[model samples]
Target: MGRHKALPYVHRTFRGWHVRRTWVNTGEVSQLNRARIVSAAIDLIEREGADAVSMRRIAADLGVGVMSLYNHVPNKAALLDGVAEAVLSEIEFTDDPSAHWTDRVRAQARSFRQIAHHYPRSTMVVVSRQLQSSSGVIPVEYALSTMLSAGFDGREAVQLLRVFIAYIVGSLLREVGVTPTFAPVRPDVDVAAIDGGLFPVVASLAGELVKCDHDEEFEFGLEMLVQAMIVRRGARASTSEPPESGVIPSPGLS
Candidate 1:
């Protein structure tokens, strides 16, 4: 038998090879989604107020194209909503089921202040818009539920929740120097420059007021608000039912 010569195999080749597009890892892409965009916006807001939080600005901050942010945030309104949600979502609900309702209220209030302090400028986004999404509404729902469980009726609970929100938002805004309701104190004017002859009380207290400790002031106001709530709760209870044996009802109730 004659030995057959082995032929070398020739691999086929095509001209003009197209390069495969490189892609970011799934983990990286996921990390760069809504959360990342919202974080960048929050940073921008904290650094330069909410007015500086444009999609283009955030994209630039994140080193991405402006169009890339649209994938996560559709428009400026939605972006603001995202920022608001981010701010409100930091308010942690009370975890101890057996905690007193008043204590829970205090906890929520403190949590709100802490988060507001963390994102001082961005927190205005929370007050400027009504949250429609479930995630955004969780804090409100939790607070209302707490009020209702404490024996307040639905209407009372809703009103009380609104009052708490208004107070907290106003306090935080004032701390950030964005007082919309009244004239903010001009930091540039020296307290000693005020005329004691013209405005005696204002001049007298100017030193103390100008140098007041905000943390102490905030806690003092919070205690007053909590005490008022306690009083309201007690009044509601008094008016809610007949006096027990040997307990005389108040004149108004009687």
Candidate 2:
């Protein structure tokens, strides 16, 4: 009778798996998985741009067949979703019941911004995609819970959250120099050539205006929003009338 052969041993790496066969010296064979594929896609995007990321490209990077990636990612849309979720996972939400909700919100915003800064090229993937993963939902739910616990009604919480997200997206876009076609031109203009008499303040501070400290600006804007939320919460507590039948406003309603 023929002896039974042992199966290959699998070694996982951030990009993929290395399969080692004991029977023969086939060296390391690549096996694709969800995490590995998503990571490779992110690396590709960071090194090149979002346009550079594709199943074919990722599979090539992993030294695996393109069809092999389908078992893990299924399709490009699903792969993008996975990539977004992976990016979202980097945001660390602290579980501290004792901490003030405002502080918690501030921390969450800062954590998000830090991740954005770390992955500037890939940040848009997170912004553009609808988050369906638990890793993405958890932080959002935590933020909403914090606001609700601090006495924000459902509508207020949702609206405030939208505003916060908008601010972060806009700020990150500016920081990363990714703007729409209609965005103000950022060309190197001659500040001295501009007539000071026509635009005295802008001309005088053109150098300072151009030299942006994105971190400082983000913090300043976030603090402003936080203060506004605090004031709104206080006013709502004092002056807002209770709804009929204890009904909370639905976020879906206009």
Across residues 192-233, which tens digit of lDDT does each residue of candidate 2 receive? 567889989977876665566777878899978877776566
**Each prediction's number of clashing residue pairs:** 0, 0
Predicted model with the maximum lDDT: 2
Q: What is the C-alpha lDDT of each candidate?
A: 0.69, 0.70
TM-score of 1: 0.73
Report RMSD for candidate 1.
Answer: 16.7
